[model samples]
Target: MADGTWRPYRVLLGSRLRSQTTYRRSFAMDLLGSLSVGALEFGEIYVIFTNVDVLGELDFAAAALLFALATICFSLADMVVGHADRLPTYLRQGTLDAFLLRPLPVLAQLITSDLSLRRLGRTAAGVAVLGVTLPHTGITWSVTTVVLLVLTIVAGTAIFAALFVCAAAIQFWLVEGAEFANAFTYGGSYAAQYPASIFALPVRVLFTFVVPAAFIAYLPTLALLDLPGPPGLPSWLGWCSPVMAVVMWAVALTGWRAGLRHYTGAGS
Candidate 1:
């Protein structure tokens, strides 16, 4: 219960990373596959942009930075907490018993159990793309801009992780994995990879209110890129992503605790 007790979490994360590294060949193949898939995704965007000069005031470099930011954040979240999304299977097979026996927090145990190294491939490529596109995009970089960009990435990761946690908690009531929830997880990532203003009003509202993803991806990109937002959106919205991430994580944690109680009572 001590606030300083991070050693156990470190051990758990190390074990998972080591297990992933053990299968070197498979890890390499997975890395290559992830890179290929990421490239193909960008390729489709490029094909779209060839005919269209701008997608809602965002040029190619600006759009590429959006993709880079979203990819890095999502990859980090998937690598850190990918196992949380598998809780339904673990619960059904009584694997939750092992987790319950542990003294650490359930969320901590869930996160450190699996390390998706394949996502590392995506993260690396995303950083590379960001580096390449950032200079071309004409964003005036200052000390503050650099700090805000770092915050944006951290906030984006937290937001996506919170979504994954909530989706995992819903498994307790649904008693199965829910693909529909993935619209917020994977679909949100895909949506953030482009300019949110390009999407329809309904989609924009869903990301803004229901999921708060626009704060993580769109608003921050607007500030970073110095691009004009759609009507009525304030310029200060960009700086609020990190705060929104904390709020979302807090809500997800509460839901997770309630779900655990439900699971214990149902004996399922």
Candidate 2:
């Protein structure tokens, strides 16, 4: 936490940022592409609203808030920890062993190794949705509401970042398990964008309790809008986002430590 302790990481991330920006044209195109994908993802909800007045008890504006919260959180998490997906490659190349020899923590080294500047485009798109929808959701703004909104973003990001780390840690065992991990990390993002009420009991349990995706957006949106959640999920559950984030990080770190102990390096 000390300034000097983080100086090395700052230097590493600074170099990565500079390397990414070195090619202006490529970086711009990457940004535009990321933005376009975000727009198209939101367009699905927009199109849905065109046909239905409400989906999962949420009107267009309310739904937009749901989408924006999930998108911003997921996009930010992906920008920060998405590269953990490369753990398998690092293992194959023996780069992970090199990390073990370094003074920095392995996870910190991995997280600070690269910075995805282009994902900011997705974050921008999410911010745009939030701006347009928050005022129209018709919710009375209070200090609590403001704090909840900020907490939703922070906790949601933590939930997703922990998910990425969890998946990466599992890769220490599965080796070629990117697809399997994506089922949670990326799949959780996909699920978060929609309301939990839209899902059946099994899926609701899966995303809500197992994956904890529901806490990322749906439950918080319900709390913010003062709406009741469907059977088994109460509005008060939204306030548990921080708790869920802590639980997820705990799980992720445990898996990471176990995987590290299990790993015998690429040669083995």
Candidate 3:
């Protein structure tokens, strides 16, 4: 953690930011598109509630809270690690090989190469939803509630970021694995917006235990609302999101290192 170590990242990220902001109209359009996508995604929850008063155990307001939390976390995580999804294209174009020649770590270089400012629009949309629905969810305002909310957002972001990196790591072997990676990253985001109780047992277990997507929003929302979780998930499980994030990072880093070792370069 020396300044020297961070200097390269600062330069790279700074340039990326400047480039993104250089065109005002383009940046604004990007934000609008991103915000529209965020709104449309939440529209799925809204549509379901329009037809029925409840989804699983959640009413419309409660479901909105869940969507906001999950969307915010997923958007923030995507801003950071979403570029890693280009691993296949980088491998094919020899961009990753050039990164290997740089003084910085490959992962660090990849991350700093392009910072997506547009994802902030999605984050903003989530904040809007949270602002609108939070009071209606019957969450008590307390120091502990505030702390849990903050922790949930931070932990959820980490969980999703790790998933992105881990999924990208698979591309070292399967150069055509973008869809496979999307299944966990984007697909996980889509699944996290709803109540886990609505899914079948097998799907619920897969997301909860294997992918830990439930920790991103569902369990945390239940904890915030002081409601009991359905069948297998306990309300207290929400507090375990930080632990889950740590475990996920461990898996992601291990897979990343193994992928690096396995990589033979673009020529191979």
Q: How close is candidate 3 to the true structure, as a TM-score?
A: 0.98
Tens digits of lDDT, candidate 1, 1-268:
5645988877777887899889889999999888877777778778988989888788888888888888888889888775677887788788887888889888888887887878888888788889999999999989878988999999999998998998888888887547767877888878778777877888888888678878777788899977779865665788899888989999899999999988863365
Candidate that beats the other on lDDT, 2 or 3, i.e. the better one:
2
lDDT (Cα, tens digit) per residue for candidate 2, span 73-168? 999999999999999998888779989999998999999988798999999999999999988999989999999999999999999999999999
Top-scoring candidate (lDDT): 2
Task: Name the runs in model 1 displaced over 4 angstroms.
Answer: 1-4, 265-268
Q: Each model's TM-score?
A: 0.94, 0.98, 0.98
Candidate 2 local distance difference test against the native: 0.95
- Please give, for residues 103-158, the per-residue lDDT of candidate 3 as tens digits: 87898888887889999999999999999998899889999999999999999999
Q: Is candidate 1 or candidate 3 better by TM-score?
A: 3
Q: Model 2 reaches what TM-score against the true structure?
A: 0.98
Question: Between 1 and 2, whose lDDT is larger?
Answer: 2
In order of listing, the candidates' clash counts read: 0, 0, 0
User: After best superposition, candidate 1 residue 97: deviation in angstroms?
Assistant: 1.7
Assess each prediction's global lDDT (C-alpha) against the native.
Answer: 0.83, 0.95, 0.92
For model 2, where is the 10-residue window of minimal lDDT? 259-268
